[model samples]
Target: MTAQDPNRVFKSGFVTIAGAPNAGKSTLLNRIVGQKVSIISSKPQTTRTRILGVCHRPGAQVVFYDTPGIFAAGDRFNAKIVGTALSAVAEADLLLAVVDAARPDPAAEELLAEKIAGRRLPVVIALNKVDLIAEKGALLAMIERWSDRRGCQAVVPVSALDGTQVEELVAALIAALPEGPPYFPEEALTDATERFIAAELIREKIFRLTGEEVPYASAVTVEAFKVSADGRKVSIAATIHLERDSQKGIVIGKGGAMLKRIGSEARREIEQMTGASVFLKLFVRVQKNWRKDAKAIERFGY
Candidate 1:
């Protein structure tokens, strides 16, 4: 193959990653962007907001929006999350719908297809988690099934966890994008602020360490973020809000051991991301069913 010209046409556009809860949308976004722009956990609905991650290919710049998982809204909080995901559809030049091949949900898939049907943009379905499928026939069946689905331009089987065939998925998405200039600076990694990423890291630890409804009912807010005069260290103070006093106790654990563990792990991640030492202080508070309260939900930045 001959060397491509520097003046070759460059394609740049936004691609939104949407799927059901625990479908590995965030993982796929991180894999494609080569960075951790969105938090990940085994818990469903881990992502509550839209995160933008930029990828600069050889001849294209693909901006990805990692959206919250789309699901049936059962309450005010869930409705807001689902709304956030659905709203991104209008802003995207193309849609990359991620589906968990290991655990398929036809109802959720149908709903997602319906939302993308009228958008008139190309939709690429990624059959993620193919590594988890023990049988090759099962994987093939899933690829066939998604190929027959409506509104899908192409179906690519991939394993987001181990980066199996992710490059192909990226190529497919880039091919769908129209020729344009870069949407963001070439050096930009994400649109999220440092404080927001710190808060999300804490929440991810909560989701991983806590059990039952504790993680779902909890929210993290970074009240203070300070960098030392020398810029060698960062001081962060955050609060963990829950719906009940009992839930707070569960997060605090015996003699505050659990809270300490969460803080320790979160601080490490924050330091790694910022390349500076961190002093993290955590406090637990009860908001008394904040998920149901519209004002509280808004105040928490949901």
Candidate 2:
């Protein structure tokens, strides 16, 4: 049957977004969800886990999972991040291998082929950040190479930041989706809990404020999330853990200004996400090498 056949039942499936670091995978995912479920930052490997954001339309439910940008495994923490990203690839019913259309890296292409080679899962390539390229021919060449190398079902060029060709990419995802019952409620946008989103939002802000390895070596934990009986407010106590006291100070900023700014930005985003005025209480602590601590890594949801 045709993709738009009225006689066909609604389609549903898990679509995983996978690519190398700074490939715009998270950006594309945020656009697809029409909300910021996955955090994005200028830093590489901003996403550390698989976050499922559901997209329900009139005739389909596309459960999209945004994963950490897949990079070559390095240290303990990075290995876990790569592990989480690869697991999403294996679990997905449809895979969108995202790539940066402006700068096509050969390493990314090699890794994509290595991970997906011989897999039977339906694969589509999304050429993201096409707006960065001045010439359309260059974008076309990149798409052609990826499509030829990967045997993609469709190669959709999109600029996730500018909303260029995003809807077409979503349509491609929907067309590839398989027939199944909706895994989430119609109104449910994400499978993650409020605590998870809050922690991620805080981390995103931290990444924005800090430089160097601060974002990579840091983790946030929500000690308590309590809602007031008034149903209009949420109170949260959270801890931001760093590997060293020096890193802690960096996160806290000079005279507490940086930490205050980070908290304010995170609180605003959390309030929007939770639909409540959030009174976020943030504390910075030294985990004393948490990334290397296996137990601490597990607790951080790595």
Best by lDDT: 1
State the number of backbone clashes in model 2: 0
Instruction: List residue ranges in candidate 2 displaced over 4 A.
Output: 1-6
lDDT of 2 by residue, 1-302 (tens): 54366798888999988888889888888888888999999888899989888887777889888888887887988898898988889998989999887888888778877887667788888888888888898876777777776447889999999999988888888888877887888788897899889999999999888999898889999999998898799999999989998898898888999999999999999999889999999999998888888899999888
Query: Which pairs clash inside model 1?
Result: none
Per-prediction count of colliding residue pairs? Answer: 0, 0
TM-score against native, each model: 0.96, 0.96
Q: How close is candidate 1 to the true structure, as a TM-score?
A: 0.96
Per-residue alpha-carbon lDDT of model 1 for 1-302, expressed as tens digits? Answer: 11145667788899999999999999999898898889999999999999999998887899999999988889889999999999998888889999998888889888878877888878899999989988878778778877876666789999999999999999898888898887788789899998899999999999999999999999999999999999899999999999998899999999999999999999999999899999999989999999999998988888
After superposition on all C-alphas, the RMSD of every candidate to the true structure, in Å, is: 1.6, 2.0
Question: Candidate 1 vs. truth: CA RMSD?
Answer: 1.6
